[model samples]
Target: MNTRCLVVCLAICAGPTFAQHIDIDPRKDVANLTGEQIYTQVCQGCHMPDAKGAVGAGRYPPLAGDVKLASGAYPAVMVMNGRGNMPAFGPMFTDAQIADVINYVRTHFGNAYTDSLEPDDVKVFRPPPPSNPPEKH
Candidate 1:
């Protein structure tokens, strides 16, 4: 990596997205965990163990083998859109964690799969968080 590119990449990845809405799993990608484990650890409470992740009347849509997240369009939509009750994990989880969770969901849930959700991939999805309050320093 050259200095200029290094600087650019550094500028892009200098800091992690700081947000109050996302929850990143310390463990890399939920895929490393069992289906039930992923549920109890990160999803169960909201989506439920049955994959019927419905929070209520259209709150959390079921993430069963129904949602077409594994499409060519990119799973970032499901994560970034904050669609319905689905919150974006771009900031909360480390890139690895995001990849893990996404891989888990893509294989276990996304019916018609196309790709694997990598951490490097998730990193790109995070379009800077709403400008942070001016630094105190």
Candidate 2:
């Protein structure tokens, strides 16, 4: 009940609380960041500035440089499915993040797919998951 004990107890209990800070730069784009700023911060590390994927498992694919994106499957599905070993960004990225990344990929890596994806498009089109096998009778 003493003031010194109370202060010491509060400090002990609040240890690590003071160190936690969740500050993050506000997102500037809805889709993945493509410019040097956002790219270097989030995409360039795994995807290389040229959009070339890495050589290991879980290595991200070469964004729009790959032909799979141009096909009718739609960019939204790709963002959601995350082929090879890339984790599904749907849960992690906002609609804008999805759009920005998709936009960056489509234009980078010497790729020619020039369509700018809208957040609404990404929001609506989720790729279908693989079907489950039938159960034995």
Candidate 3:
């Protein structure tokens, strides 16, 4: 096959894969951005622009007034560590960023939960330190 023809064929074959791919920004500084901005740029791809979630090959639960969000801790952990099909974003965002996004989701999309999370609150959910060998009692 000629190089030109091979390149064309590869492009045709790769088109669908690119179309189905969702781009999530890998930037680490989300603290300065508003919750809506973070959601629009990052979460919108999966959770959707409306924050209603989606279903197809996989299920994404809606964030609109979800009872699970009544506790800020639930969403904070999910955002930080990820759950099910969601990717872990803990390393990609600061505590303040995670808290801001969680707070946004909790308060928006018909969700009326009044609680707001702080960086300390998110820190508490982090995996605990490894325990030392128990001393003989």
| Clash number for each model | 6, 9, 0
User: Best-fitting candidate, measured by lDDT?
Assistant: 3
lDDT of 3 by residue, 38-106 (tens): 677667766777878888656777888689999998998898788876767676567887888899888
Could you give candidate 1's per-residue lDDT for residues 1-137 as a string of tens digits?
A: 22332332233334334211233323333325543454455555566666565544445556678555645236555554456445454554456655665566666654546577665676676676678788797
Candidates' C-alpha lDDT = 0.51, 0.55, 0.71
**Model 2: residues >4 Å from true position, as ranges?**
1-38, 57-59, 71-73, 126-137
Better candidate number, 1 or 2, judged by lDDT = 2
Evaluated with TM-score, which candidate comes out highest? Answer: 3
TM-score versus the correct structure, for each prediction: 0.54, 0.55, 0.70
What's the candidate order when arranged by decreasing lDDT?
3, 2, 1
- Give the TM-score comparing model 1 with the true structure, all chains together: 0.54
> Lowest-lDDT window of 10 residues in candidate 2?
21-30
- Candidate 2 overall lDDT versus native: 0.55
Better of 2 and 3 by TM-score: 3
Give the lowest summed-lDDT range of ten residues in model 3.
22-31
Instruction: Report clash pairs, candidate 3.
Output: none
